[model samples]
Target: MTMNDLQELFVHKLAQQYYVERELVEALDEMARHTTNDRMSQGFADHREETRTQVQRLEEVFAALDRPAEARNSSVLEGLEEDRRELESRIEDDELLNMVYLNAGMMTERVEMTAYEGLTTLGEQLELGNDVQTPLESNYEEEKSAFRELETLATAKDLKSLWEQLTPS
Candidate 1:
Protein backbone atom coordinates (compact mmCIF):
# COMPACT_ATOMS: atom_id res chain seq x y z
CA MET A 1 0.00 0.00 0.00
CA THR A 2 2.09 2.89 -1.19
CA MET A 3 0.73 6.44 -1.55
CA ASN A 4 3.44 8.22 -3.51
CA ASP A 5 1.26 10.82 -5.21
CA LEU A 6 -2.35 11.59 -6.05
CA GLN A 7 -1.62 10.59 -9.61
CA GLU A 8 -0.32 7.27 -8.37
CA LEU A 9 -3.41 6.81 -6.27
CA PHE A 10 -5.57 7.31 -9.34
CA VAL A 11 -3.49 4.84 -11.22
CA HIS A 12 -4.12 2.27 -8.54
CA LYS A 13 -7.86 2.76 -8.69
CA LEU A 14 -7.74 2.90 -12.47
CA ALA A 15 -5.86 -0.35 -12.53
CA GLN A 16 -8.64 -2.06 -10.64
CA GLN A 17 -11.23 -0.41 -12.81
CA TYR A 18 -9.38 -1.35 -15.94
CA TYR A 19 -9.26 -4.96 -14.84
CA VAL A 20 -12.98 -5.01 -14.18
CA GLU A 21 -13.76 -3.39 -17.50
CA ARG A 22 -11.73 -6.04 -19.25
CA GLU A 23 -13.54 -8.73 -17.35
CA LEU A 24 -16.88 -7.20 -18.28
CA VAL A 25 -15.93 -7.21 -21.93
CA GLU A 26 -15.55 -10.98 -21.86
CA ALA A 27 -18.61 -11.47 -19.71
CA LEU A 28 -20.73 -9.28 -21.92
CA ASP A 29 -19.63 -11.23 -24.95
CA GLU A 30 -20.75 -14.47 -23.39
CA MET A 31 -23.99 -12.91 -22.25
CA ALA A 32 -24.66 -11.70 -25.76
CA ARG A 33 -24.07 -15.15 -27.15
CA HIS A 34 -26.51 -16.65 -24.68
CA THR A 35 -29.23 -14.06 -25.09
CA THR A 36 -32.14 -15.00 -27.37
CA ASN A 37 -33.24 -11.53 -28.34
CA ASP A 38 -31.29 -10.08 -31.24
CA ARG A 39 -31.53 -6.53 -29.98
CA MET A 40 -30.48 -7.45 -26.47
CA SER A 41 -27.65 -9.55 -27.75
CA GLN A 42 -26.58 -6.78 -30.08
CA GLY A 43 -26.56 -4.32 -27.20
CA PHE A 44 -24.01 -6.38 -25.30
CA ALA A 45 -22.07 -7.02 -28.48
CA ASP A 46 -21.74 -3.30 -29.17
CA HIS A 47 -20.62 -2.67 -25.63
CA ARG A 48 -18.01 -5.39 -25.92
CA GLU A 49 -16.53 -3.53 -28.86
CA GLU A 50 -16.74 -0.30 -26.88
CA THR A 51 -14.98 -1.91 -23.95
CA ARG A 52 -12.15 -3.02 -26.22
CA THR A 53 -11.34 0.56 -27.17
CA GLN A 54 -11.69 1.69 -23.61
CA VAL A 55 -9.12 -0.89 -22.55
CA GLN A 56 -6.70 0.64 -25.01
CA ARG A 57 -7.42 4.06 -23.59
CA LEU A 58 -6.76 2.73 -20.13
CA GLU A 59 -3.41 1.45 -21.31
CA GLU A 60 -2.62 4.97 -22.47
CA VAL A 61 -3.56 6.31 -19.07
CA PHE A 62 -1.17 3.88 -17.42
CA ALA A 63 1.56 4.87 -19.82
CA ALA A 64 1.00 8.53 -19.07
CA LEU A 65 1.31 7.94 -15.36
CA ASP A 66 4.38 5.72 -15.74
CA ARG A 67 2.60 2.82 -14.05
CA PRO A 68 2.13 -0.68 -15.31
CA ALA A 69 -1.45 -1.57 -16.13
CA GLU A 70 -1.90 -4.24 -13.49
CA ALA A 71 -5.15 -5.90 -12.67
CA ARG A 72 -6.46 -6.10 -9.14
CA ASN A 73 -9.12 -8.82 -8.98
CA SER A 74 -12.53 -7.16 -8.88
CA SER A 75 -14.99 -9.02 -6.63
CA VAL A 76 -17.66 -6.49 -7.52
CA LEU A 77 -17.62 -7.65 -11.11
CA GLU A 78 -17.06 -11.26 -10.11
CA GLY A 79 -20.19 -11.29 -7.99
CA LEU A 80 -22.25 -9.84 -10.79
CA GLU A 81 -20.87 -12.44 -13.18
CA GLU A 82 -21.78 -15.23 -10.82
CA ASP A 83 -25.28 -13.87 -10.56
CA ARG A 84 -25.49 -13.78 -14.35
CA ARG A 85 -24.52 -17.41 -14.51
CA GLU A 86 -27.09 -18.41 -11.96
CA LEU A 87 -29.84 -16.43 -13.63
CA GLU A 88 -29.13 -18.04 -16.97
CA SER A 89 -29.38 -21.48 -15.46
CA ARG A 90 -32.77 -20.82 -13.87
CA ILE A 91 -34.62 -18.86 -16.55
CA GLU A 92 -35.99 -20.88 -19.45
CA ASP A 93 -38.80 -18.58 -20.52
CA ASP A 94 -38.11 -15.93 -23.16
CA GLU A 95 -39.90 -13.23 -21.18
CA LEU A 96 -37.80 -14.05 -18.20
CA LEU A 97 -34.60 -13.87 -20.19
CA ASN A 98 -35.43 -10.45 -21.60
CA MET A 99 -36.17 -9.07 -18.16
CA VAL A 100 -33.09 -10.69 -16.74
CA TYR A 101 -30.83 -9.36 -19.49
CA LEU A 102 -32.14 -5.85 -18.93
CA ASN A 103 -31.43 -6.12 -15.26
CA ALA A 104 -27.93 -7.45 -15.83
CA GLY A 105 -27.09 -4.75 -18.37
CA MET A 106 -28.29 -2.09 -15.99
CA MET A 107 -26.19 -3.57 -13.22
CA THR A 108 -23.07 -3.53 -15.39
CA GLU A 109 -23.65 0.11 -16.30
CA ARG A 110 -24.14 1.12 -12.67
CA VAL A 111 -21.00 -0.66 -11.55
CA GLU A 112 -19.00 1.04 -14.29
CA MET A 113 -20.47 4.46 -13.53
CA THR A 114 -19.55 4.16 -9.88
CA ALA A 115 -16.00 3.04 -10.67
CA TYR A 116 -15.52 5.83 -13.21
CA GLU A 117 -16.87 8.45 -10.83
CA GLY A 118 -14.29 7.48 -8.23
CA LEU A 119 -11.52 7.42 -10.76
CA THR A 120 -12.58 10.76 -12.20
CA THR A 121 -12.58 12.37 -8.78
CA LEU A 122 -9.13 11.00 -8.08
CA GLY A 123 -7.91 12.36 -11.42
CA GLU A 124 -9.31 15.83 -10.66
CA GLN A 125 -7.72 15.80 -7.21
CA LEU A 126 -4.42 15.00 -8.86
CA GLU A 127 -4.93 17.73 -11.47
CA LEU A 128 -4.56 15.31 -14.38
CA GLY A 129 -6.63 17.67 -16.56
CA ASN A 130 -8.52 16.62 -19.67
CA ASP A 131 -5.97 14.07 -20.73
CA VAL A 132 -7.48 11.57 -18.29
CA GLN A 133 -10.77 13.31 -17.62
CA THR A 134 -11.86 13.28 -21.25
CA PRO A 135 -11.81 9.53 -21.64
CA LEU A 136 -13.45 9.01 -18.26
CA GLU A 137 -16.25 11.31 -19.28
CA SER A 138 -16.70 9.30 -22.43
CA ASN A 139 -16.91 6.16 -20.36
CA TYR A 140 -19.52 7.78 -18.14
CA GLU A 141 -21.58 8.90 -21.09
CA GLU A 142 -21.47 5.45 -22.71
CA GLU A 143 -22.67 3.71 -19.58
CA LYS A 144 -25.49 6.17 -19.22
CA SER A 145 -26.42 5.68 -22.84
CA ALA A 146 -26.55 1.92 -22.49
CA PHE A 147 -28.60 2.11 -19.31
CA ARG A 148 -31.11 4.49 -20.83
CA GLU A 149 -31.53 2.27 -23.84
CA LEU A 150 -32.29 -0.66 -21.57
CA GLU A 151 -34.75 1.43 -19.62
CA THR A 152 -36.76 2.06 -22.78
CA LEU A 153 -37.02 -1.65 -23.59
CA ALA A 154 -37.48 -2.83 -20.04
CA THR A 155 -41.14 -2.06 -20.31
CA ALA A 156 -43.62 -4.93 -20.19
CA LYS A 157 -44.73 -4.68 -23.82
CA ASP A 158 -41.25 -4.64 -25.22
CA LEU A 159 -40.17 -7.51 -23.02
CA LYS A 160 -43.22 -9.61 -23.97
CA SER A 161 -42.72 -9.10 -27.70
CA LEU A 162 -39.02 -9.79 -27.51
CA TRP A 163 -39.61 -12.83 -25.34
CA GLU A 164 -42.07 -14.26 -27.84
CA GLN A 165 -39.64 -13.64 -30.67
CA LEU A 166 -36.80 -15.32 -28.77
CA THR A 167 -38.37 -18.24 -26.99
CA PRO A 168 -39.32 -21.21 -29.11
CA SER A 169 -40.87 -22.95 -26.16
Candidate 2:
Protein backbone atom coordinates (compact mmCIF):
# COMPACT_ATOMS: atom_id res chain seq x y z
CA MET A 1 0.00 0.00 0.00
CA THR A 2 1.31 3.39 -1.02
CA MET A 3 1.84 5.91 1.77
CA ASN A 4 -0.23 8.91 0.80
CA ASP A 5 -3.26 10.09 2.70
CA LEU A 6 -5.02 10.17 6.09
CA GLN A 7 -6.32 6.64 5.61
CA GLU A 8 -2.84 5.22 5.39
CA LEU A 9 -1.81 7.29 8.39
CA PHE A 10 -4.75 5.88 10.30
CA VAL A 11 -3.73 2.31 9.52
CA HIS A 12 -0.21 2.98 10.73
CA LYS A 13 -1.64 4.55 13.86
CA LEU A 14 -3.73 1.46 14.53
CA ALA A 15 -0.65 -0.72 14.08
CA GLN A 16 1.19 1.39 16.62
CA GLN A 17 -1.66 0.92 19.09
CA TYR A 18 -1.59 -2.83 18.49
CA TYR A 19 2.03 -2.88 19.58
CA VAL A 20 1.28 -0.66 22.56
CA GLU A 21 -1.45 -3.02 23.76
CA ARG A 22 0.92 -6.00 23.63
CA GLU A 23 3.60 -4.08 25.47
CA LEU A 24 1.10 -3.08 28.13
CA VAL A 25 0.03 -6.66 28.81
CA GLU A 26 3.55 -7.56 29.92
CA ALA A 27 4.02 -4.30 31.76
CA LEU A 28 0.74 -4.69 33.59
CA ASP A 29 1.66 -8.20 34.69
CA GLU A 30 4.89 -6.96 36.21
CA MET A 31 3.08 -4.04 37.75
CA ALA A 32 0.54 -6.37 39.33
CA ARG A 33 3.35 -8.28 40.99
CA HIS A 34 5.08 -5.15 42.22
CA THR A 35 2.10 -3.33 43.69
CA THR A 36 1.59 -3.65 47.46
CA ASN A 37 -2.08 -2.71 47.35
CA ASP A 38 -4.31 -5.66 46.61
CA ARG A 39 -6.94 -3.65 44.80
CA MET A 40 -4.38 -1.93 42.62
CA SER A 41 -2.66 -5.23 41.93
CA GLN A 42 -5.94 -6.81 40.90
CA GLY A 43 -6.73 -3.83 38.75
CA PHE A 44 -3.49 -4.31 36.84
CA ALA A 45 -4.16 -8.00 36.41
CA ASP A 46 -7.71 -7.37 35.22
CA HIS A 47 -6.52 -4.76 32.79
CA ARG A 48 -3.92 -7.16 31.48
CA GLU A 49 -6.73 -9.44 30.45
CA GLU A 50 -8.66 -6.53 29.03
CA THR A 51 -5.61 -5.52 27.03
CA ARG A 52 -5.45 -8.97 25.48
CA THR A 53 -9.02 -8.57 24.31
CA GLN A 54 -8.21 -5.11 23.03
CA VAL A 55 -5.38 -6.54 20.91
CA GLN A 56 -7.70 -9.16 19.44
CA ARG A 57 -10.19 -6.41 18.62
CA LEU A 58 -7.44 -4.51 16.86
CA GLU A 59 -6.76 -7.60 14.78
CA GLU A 60 -10.44 -7.74 13.91
CA VAL A 61 -10.32 -4.12 12.87
CA PHE A 62 -7.40 -4.89 10.58
CA ALA A 63 -9.30 -7.80 9.08
CA ALA A 64 -12.19 -5.52 8.31
CA LEU A 65 -9.80 -3.17 6.54
CA ASP A 66 -8.35 -6.04 4.48
CA ARG A 67 -4.96 -5.58 6.14
CA PRO A 68 -2.76 -7.91 8.11
CA ALA A 69 -2.92 -7.75 11.92
CA GLU A 70 0.48 -6.09 12.07
CA ALA A 71 2.27 -4.07 14.70
CA ARG A 72 4.53 -1.10 14.32
CA ASN A 73 7.18 -0.25 16.91
CA SER A 74 5.71 1.97 19.59
CA SER A 75 8.37 4.35 20.88
CA VAL A 76 5.81 6.11 23.04
CA LEU A 77 5.01 2.95 24.98
CA GLU A 78 8.69 2.14 25.29
CA GLY A 79 9.45 5.52 26.76
CA LEU A 80 6.56 5.26 29.22
CA GLU A 81 7.74 1.83 30.36
CA GLU A 82 11.26 3.10 30.80
CA ASP A 83 10.04 5.96 32.92
CA ARG A 84 7.98 3.57 35.01
CA ARG A 85 11.05 1.43 35.66
CA GLU A 86 13.00 4.45 36.79
CA LEU A 87 10.19 5.58 39.06
CA GLU A 88 9.88 2.17 40.67
CA SER A 89 13.59 2.02 41.36
CA ARG A 90 13.64 5.43 43.02
CA ILE A 91 10.55 5.17 45.23
CA GLU A 92 11.16 3.30 48.50
CA ASP A 93 7.90 3.69 50.42
CA ASP A 94 5.35 1.06 49.48
CA GLU A 95 2.38 3.39 49.77
CA LEU A 96 4.18 6.12 47.91
CA LEU A 97 5.13 3.59 45.29
CA ASN A 98 1.51 2.49 44.95
CA MET A 99 0.37 6.06 44.50
CA VAL A 100 3.09 6.67 41.97
CA TYR A 101 2.13 3.53 40.11
CA LEU A 102 -1.50 4.59 39.95
CA ASN A 103 -0.45 7.98 38.64
CA ALA A 104 1.69 6.31 36.01
CA GLY A 105 -1.24 4.14 35.02
CA MET A 106 -3.44 7.18 34.64
CA MET A 107 -0.84 8.73 32.39
CA THR A 108 -0.70 5.60 30.26
CA GLU A 109 -4.49 5.44 30.08
CA ARG A 110 -4.62 9.04 28.93
CA VAL A 111 -2.26 8.31 26.08
CA GLU A 112 -4.27 5.27 25.01
CA MET A 113 -7.53 7.19 25.28
CA THR A 114 -6.15 9.95 23.10
CA ALA A 115 -4.89 7.49 20.50
CA TYR A 116 -8.16 5.58 20.40
CA GLU A 117 -10.20 8.76 20.14
CA GLY A 118 -8.09 9.95 17.24
CA LEU A 119 -8.30 6.56 15.54
CA THR A 120 -12.06 6.51 15.97
CA THR A 121 -12.26 9.94 14.40
CA LEU A 122 -9.96 8.88 11.59
CA GLY A 123 -12.03 5.78 10.93
CA GLU A 124 -15.06 8.00 10.58
CA GLN A 125 -13.23 10.41 8.28
CA LEU A 126 -12.12 7.53 6.02
CA GLU A 127 -15.67 6.18 5.85
CA LEU A 128 -14.41 2.92 7.37
CA GLY A 129 -17.86 2.77 9.00
CA ASN A 130 -18.86 1.44 12.44
CA ASP A 131 -16.97 -1.82 12.04
CA VAL A 132 -13.67 -0.06 12.70
CA GLN A 133 -14.92 2.86 14.71
CA THR A 134 -16.92 0.78 17.17
CA PRO A 135 -13.98 -1.17 18.51
CA LEU A 136 -11.86 1.93 18.74
CA GLU A 137 -14.60 3.63 20.69
CA SER A 138 -14.94 0.66 22.98
CA ASN A 139 -11.22 0.71 23.70
CA TYR A 140 -11.42 4.43 24.34
CA GLU A 141 -14.17 3.95 26.92
CA GLU A 142 -12.19 1.21 28.65
CA GLU A 143 -9.17 3.44 28.88
CA LYS A 144 -11.29 6.22 30.30
CA SER A 145 -12.74 3.90 32.91
CA ALA A 146 -9.29 2.70 33.89
CA PHE A 147 -8.14 6.28 34.29
CA ARG A 148 -11.00 6.97 36.67
CA GLU A 149 -10.18 3.95 38.77
CA LEU A 150 -6.55 4.96 38.96
CA GLU A 151 -7.59 8.40 40.13
CA THR A 152 -9.67 6.92 42.93
CA LEU A 153 -6.80 4.69 44.00
CA ALA A 154 -4.39 7.57 43.89
CA THR A 155 -6.53 9.67 46.21
CA ALA A 156 -7.53 7.11 48.82
CA LYS A 157 -6.71 8.19 52.39
CA ASP A 158 -6.14 4.75 53.90
CA LEU A 159 -2.82 4.34 52.16
CA LYS A 160 -1.42 7.45 53.80
CA SER A 161 -0.38 5.55 56.95
CA LEU A 162 1.71 3.18 54.87
CA TRP A 163 3.75 6.11 53.72
CA GLU A 164 4.11 7.46 57.25
CA GLN A 165 5.18 4.10 58.61
CA LEU A 166 7.99 3.91 56.10
CA THR A 167 9.08 7.48 56.57
CA PRO A 168 12.72 7.89 57.56
CA SER A 169 13.30 8.56 61.26
lDDT of 2 by residue, 44-161 (tens): 9999999999999999899999999989988888888889889889989777788777877988999999999889888888899888988888888888988898877766666555
The lDDT per prediction is 0.81, 0.88
Report the lDDT of model 2 for residue 31: 88
Candidate 1 lDDT, 1-169, residue by residue in tens: 7698876677778988889888988888887887877888998899899888888878777777767778887888888888878988998876676677778888888888898889889888888878778888788788788888777767557686765776697
Each prediction's RMSD to truth: 3.7, 2.6
TM-score of each: 0.86, 0.90
The Cα error of candidate 2 at residue 125, in Å, is 0.6
Among all windows of ten consecutive residues in candidate 2, which has the lowest summed lDDT? Answer: 158-167
Candidate 2 residue 44 Cα shift, in angstroms, is 0.7
Candidate 2, position 70, lDDT: 89
Q: In candidate 1, how many clashes are counted?
A: 0
**Which pairs clash (backbone N, Cα, C closer than 3 Å) in model 2?**
none
